[model samples]
Target chain A: MNDTRLIRVVDDDPELRRSLGWMLGGAGLAAELYTSAEQFLERDDLHRSGCVLVDVRMPHMDGLELQRRIRRRGSQLPVVVMSGHADVPTAVHAMEEGALSFLEKPFTKDELLGVLGRALQRADELVQREAAHRADLARIADLTPRELEVMRLVVGGELTKRIAQQLGISERTVDKHRERILAKTGAESWAGLTLLAARLELVSGQPVEALATA
Target chain B: MSTGRDQRQTEPGSVERTPAFPSDAFDHLVSQIDDVFWLYDCQRERVDYVSPAYDRVWGRSAARLLADPLDGLNNAVVAEHREEVRRAFLAGLESGRFEAKYRIRLPDGSERWIHDRGFPIRDPQGRVVHFAGVARDFTERKLTQDRLRESEAFLRATLDALPAHIAIVDPQGVILAVNRSWRQFAECNGLAAPDHAVGLNYLKVCDDAVGPDAAVAREVARGMRGVLDGSQSELMVSYPCDSPDERRWFELRVARFETNRCPLLVAIHLDVTARRRAEEQAVRQQAELAHVARVATIGEMAAGIAHELNQPLSAIANYAEGCLDRVGDDRRPRSDLVDALVHIRNLAQSSGAIIRRLRSAARKSEPRRSSICLNAAVRETVELVRYELETDGVVLEMQLADHLPVVQGDAVQIQQVLLNLLLNAQSAVRHREQPRLTIATRSGKNDVRVSVVDNGPGFGAVAPDRMFESFYSSKPDGLGLGLAISRSIVEAHGGSIWAERVDGCSFFHFTVPYSRPDIASGPPPGVSETGRRLGPAQHKEATA
Candidate 1:
């Protein structure tokens, strides 16, 4: 899987593109090439698990614009920018905008490859965290209707008996729902339940609105 | 009967030709030549016979010569040759078959040279009996030989006395002879004297003077050899001679002395040192004068040339800075950035070109020649000098012809010329309330014409002919060399330049030869280029 992680490179200059591609391949990484930001959009391999290499200055569209466009497309690929001539403020701005790194050109092959490797690792971690976070949120969404109501009330600082009144149920019934919430969330008490509800805010926020409508 | 007849004949023949006298035969032989001959009877030491021819040779008859027989012939010879002739004649008579040559004068105011020949006559018994001789006149041959000797001596003396160095070499390039002047010249030049110059090769001298340029040495050697080998005309080679001052010019002339296949050469050297020195001095002075003129012109128009560059340099610095700023923004307008870059490049090139022209002009460096559009140069100069022109209220206009061909010249020099004229025109119209300047350009078959016309106060009564003379300006601060130098620059480019005025406007007109000057033809008549004429209104208005 790590071998199949394809590094995407976007540079208008053919020499820089081939050179960067060779550098990535030499470092035991696969490289996919794109000439421009527009070309990258037309490419179907945007979901590839690798870093995006881009030049700061190019014809038609520059690196920063391409970075913005890639971000809007919500691709998980990390974008790296490079320039031949010095552009200090532009490099600073690109770095501030979640660019993996901004390299000045004539940058050594080792420096660029090192930056790309770190960027690819960061992308992999990001994709995994996003997948795990989505699965946890799906598990929290499977709570019973009454338990979801109590989970929201308990985290909203309402008493368990108050939460039972709001749902027209006994305090014992609310306490029993709290126990199931702690078990499902792997929390030990009400505090743990509240911590689990906060971590599963994606499911907690939506279910409270559904309980309110019911 | 014969005995009595013989007795009578023998008695008479004794006075005429006697058979009984053996000495008479020797006398007859001597008479055949104009010589004195004598025979002595060896046994008695007495004269046996003497010829009458001795009378004509010795200025005395044979009878008288015999009367004073033993006397030397000195008294009868020329006074100077008398004793010498006598001793020579006596010695010849003593020897067998003796000959003597001597001079004698006739009593008739004439001199004669005589060659006397004497022989001893022998008897049948082999005893010496008489001395016989002959004499011939040989004065003409001796006189001719003496005159030839004198002429050769005089020629040698004259060659030695010449001021110019001279030498004569044989066909084999051996220094056969040289004059005194050449010897002196060689000594002064640190070369061996002519006496030691003989038998030396000529190529060694050239190789010493000019460093090892083998081709020149070979060419000269071939020419020298040809001259020695029956060439009719002399060959001459000249080069710069060694001298601290510019005064030395050496001319080497080589000529053959024979018509057939023989190796003999006659080489002569002449020193033209003074003329060469004068030429060098004149060339140096001319260069200095040109430099002075360039400096003076630059000094007079320092403000103008500076102004020409300042504007472009300022523009370039601004555009480059602007480009850097625009490219720094996150909201960088791509089109504006590109435009700024283009502007920066254009300004840089333009400024570079302007600075190059200024440096070349200031340093008096050689001009860079190319085919230039005359109209463009004129327009460029006007814009460059516009500030001064406008300050004087001189409105500049152009009537440039379209599709004009290029002209050949240094563009920078032409621009300088146009700048000078434009500034002059501006200055001329400065006093007027409303000044107008017009620049017109047109092309002909092999030329392009440019004119700067101004209307304010015309040249009035000043003759157009003297306008180009140095220091012939009407203005208080005019350096009259402007038009003069301009015309010279134009003429150097192989074109015609002049100025003419109409009513109230003066037009400085000049032509530039075509880029390829070989194709140029004369301009058409009466149709002034730029299609401009001196209208009656211009002339009358300026005169008023």
Candidate 2:
């Protein structure tokens, strides 16, 4: 685990927070502790590459609420929910709210480290995906309006002839447009370009079909 | 008067001659009198002269009595008295004196009681010359005497039939009279007197009382003195007077009264053993029910309690794990590991305390009364339910008053009451968007008051006071014994419990009296040391 990748422990219990900090530090991961979800939410570095471990039962803002707020803020800081007992309903709720893992308290040091590792891995993946989507948006922004239309059709699995007919252009012109779309998006093949477009659709909040129509 | 005496001294044959001294005046006086004045000739065995009053008494003419001296005795006297009258008449002639009481049969068949007496009239030589007798009618006096005797007998019977040991005392504390029950009790207790110690100074007896009843007896004596001296109108005190064969209780009541302008005291000792037993039984049953309720409450909150206990255990695990992780790293400061170990120890101790509290609450033990700080008790009880409230997202605010006087009560029972109220509030606010509960303690004039206010739908159409009724439940799954048991426990602790709705909040309030400093060092008066020690044991036996 990268020492720079912080493990944020948010709980109402000060002792638990302190002990968790010590445990994470001993495991070669840097840790930051907050006594409550509200205190955790006050961090300006939520966009940093890290995961937050929050207690599900807190005073003001619970772990699930914090998770929702993080999502709303567009920060993919993976949330790891901790519950004092085997509270299945709350665990399920936290998981549904995009928690990376649900850890019941009195968890072993290995369990804590394992869950934190997974949460950090998830955070890294989300950051990479966000960067890739930003790169994709920029690459897509570079294309001409006509080439962009052809790229959408090609990614939609339309044949080159059908794409040329839909856009009222020649088959040769549609093929040329697809080649440039692939080169600008840095794709090695047509399938690769389609895969990139699918990933873009997932992160960009737009459906592939909608982007194809556009 | 001289002419009437001269006529009596004259010979029987010379009685018809008028005396020179004022014969008309004497005759007029004799005719006006109500007594039947008659002169009998003892030697001749005949009646010489009979006054006009004889006609009225015998219901015959005076001349007829002269013709037959024995006419009145034979005809006027009832058959039951005829022989006795004849014997008295003859004895009077022989002995020169006569006295007899007999009933006379009137012409209308009504019998009148008569007291007759005769005195001998002798000459100067001291020889008996004639028997002068006055047969005066005293029937009214005799009838009045009979009625008075009958009424007195009825009053005595009524007083004797009462169950209370009753004695009437004078204003000076002297026992004037005692009834049959009092006498019987005295006899059974081997009191020294045939009249059940009547005329004895009651105050002295109370003052001289020994053994376990001395204090109560002294108190009774003081109270009786208060009543008798008009400082108090009445006195009532209940004391235990257990016999060798059975436990007993008696209520002594002394009331002052006036009859015939003389003040008196009626001290009555009523047997109240059955009432005390019933009260003790109720208290025992309440304690038993409270124990059951406490167990049931713990059962209901098992999940929450487990979670509450789990918090500390979880913290301890985390701290221990952290310390272990640091123990291997040389770069980690020793102080950090030491701190983590300390946290682990503290957490372990806290969890143990929680378990201890839970065990004590769940265990069936005798209810013990002691002076307890209300704030401390409230905090301890709040610790048990804090997790449940927090888990349910209910906000709890405690406003405990500072320097609250200690209340006398059973800590477990009081805690049960607090727990019941808290749980009820928690359940009431379970469905609310933002549930809030506030528990506040305040010192009142004579008690410490605790109030639990909840911001849920206030006690809707049901009267607030009815909430304490047993089996009166608004919840579908409720047994409805929590508040009832709480009320009983509070009342047994010399407190009161009530509920009210104010300003859109449901408030449950209970007050436990402040422990009296004087009584704090000893058991309450009127209870013997053995009885005090045996109270819970007796209750347990009875329950078993």
Candidate 3:
């Protein structure tokens, strides 16, 4: 699956891009190429698990601004920004926006390949986390009405007895509902479930009344 | 012709038209006197004693004057001065003293000026009994006085109206006089009453000049002292006298105003700030133009420079990756790794070359000229851009002449021109696998010409004559200063640069003449541009 995933190389120089693609291919990574950032955007490469490798000082639609646009669009695609000596400061500053790493040129092939690999790995991790969040959200929807009320209270940090009191149920009955919710959602711990909900932007760490509508 | 007694017959009550005495000696003295001596008796109120001198002084006979002294004298006095002479006479008549000056028309039809003085003779009771007076002709002294006064007035008017500030200082260093401009300058500088400066020592005034102009004042004082001591006949110096806000320059000139009686020094100041400012403005404008060209050229080539540097870097990366791959497999020969290492080394060297070129291009350095071969300059410039030319897949060819004579020029400036022309040729042929650029040098009897010829779309639809204008650009990103600065550099070397278009070829040609012994030994003052000798064809090349 890792071999099947692609790395997109965007550069102004055709020969350099081809050489980089050949280098990456030797590392058991697939390579897709674009001559410029505009080409990369037009080809819809941002929606893929493959990361974008950009040289910082391109002629048009240079890499730093492209990194900003990609992040603004909320794409999970990671970018590896590289630049020559004159453009190193801007490339390094672009790292703040979740660039995989800033690489300086005349980098060894291993360094380029390593940063590209990290960018792809970040994209893969993001995609998997997004799928997990969606699965967790689906599991929350599968809860019974009573279980939903109990889980919201539990994630809200109420004790089992307090949860039962809030739901007007017995303590044992609240415990039974918590067990069912945890089993169905596959949450390893109560705090873990809240953190997952926060990551999905579904609920606050301290769940409030708004969770009913969610 | 008629005298005292005969005249009294018309008057009577005149016992003394004279004194009824004929002393021959006294009569002779009175007749010869230049003054008109007269006596009038108050009691008689009519007759008067008269001297024969009346005819010589008033051009009238004593009988005519004595008959009607007031009317006769009024006629003798010029008509315009009649009332003035009469008023003075009447005033003295009461005071018992008389003094008056008046113009008279003589019987000879000529003009004469007269002076009249009279005294009253009083009795013991202090009452005037007789009046006596002398009237003298003073025309000669009056003429000389009038001429001197008119000449002085003319000199004053001419000096006051001049634009130059003029001051006359005495040998003792006191200012004797100053013209209008000198007083106006003092007034503008808060020295309100100019009379104070007139008597003030000029050397003392020079001591008060402060700040940037202190030196100017000191120098002026030295020169003025030289003029004062008679050691130097003249002082001529120009100096800046600036206020805090604006700059001003003045020329100070001092020369001896020699006279047989008393020698004086004449000092003059003329403002020359406008001409100085104009010259300084021209120098500043040329520097700004050169700076703009340098900055715009670099800005336009930024992307190209980045691309150039990146190629070597990417090649280095690709080579290392190939070496690693070969090592991991253990199937490739040791020679493969060595080849990869060598390629990496060359790529690194190319990147270094690009950086050095960019630094030199961006450095704002004054042109440093030295002895250089045209072929060597061409070779060094090509080396700087060789990687870019090769990467762009352009076929570069050169036919540098052998045994080429050295030219006097700035190596960096010449290299800059060659680089600009080469880049122009490179960009002209976009997407071509073989964009042929050829550089050739040929020696003539007195000069060497270098040409950059490219087989690209030759100056398409654009007139070749308009190629070197500062803001004319064919490329979208070009600032168009490249060719203009190139032409300026070439011309600064006393050569000529031009463009030609023929048969789908764009050629840029420039020539530098061999340094001549006469010209090289005698470079102009402030002319650091040493090696330039204008060829006969340079003017034609420019017009073309």
Instruction: List, for all models, the DockQ compared with the true complex.
Output: 0.01, 0.40, 0.16
Q: Write model 2 residue lDDT over A1-214, tens digit each, in one string.
A: 4456888888887777887787676667888888877777786488678899888888778889988988998787888999887889998888888888999977888898898888888878887888876776766767776776677677777899888788898999877888787777677887877777676663344544445434
Candidate 2: which pairs clash? none
Give per-residue CA lDDT, model 3, range A111-186, as digits (tens). Answer: 7767776777787788888788667667676677677667666666788878777778899988888788789888
Considering just the first chain, candidate 2 attains a TM-score of 0.78
> For all the models shown, what interface RMSD does each have?
19.0, 1.9, 5.1
Q: Any residue pairs clashing in model 3, and if so which?
A: B493-B532, B494-B532
Per-residue lDDT of candidate 3, residues B108-165 (tens digit): 8899988888776655565667666677877988998888888888888898888777
Instruction: Rank candidates, TM-score, best first.
Output: 2, 1, 3
> Would you list the C-alpha lDDT of every candidate in the order shown?
0.63, 0.77, 0.71
Give the candidate number with the greatest TM-score.
Answer: 2
Candidate 2: interface RMSD equals: 1.9
How well is each residue in B417-494 modelled by candidate 1, as lDDT tens digits?
787678778878877777878888988777888888887577768887688777888778776777776766676567
- TM-score versus the correct structure, for each prediction: 0.42, 0.72, 0.38
Q: Tens digits of per-residue lDDT for model 2 on B264-351?
A: 8898877777877786676677778899889988998898887777777777777777677678879768988887788888888888
CA shift of A128, model 1, Å: 61
Summing lDDT over every window of 10 consecutive residues in candidate 2 chain B, give the lowest-scoring window. B531-540
Best model number under lDDT: 2
What TM-score results for chain B in every one of the models?
0.53, 0.75, 0.49
Task: Kindly report the root-mean-square deviation of model 1 from the true structure over all alpha carbons.
Answer: 24.9
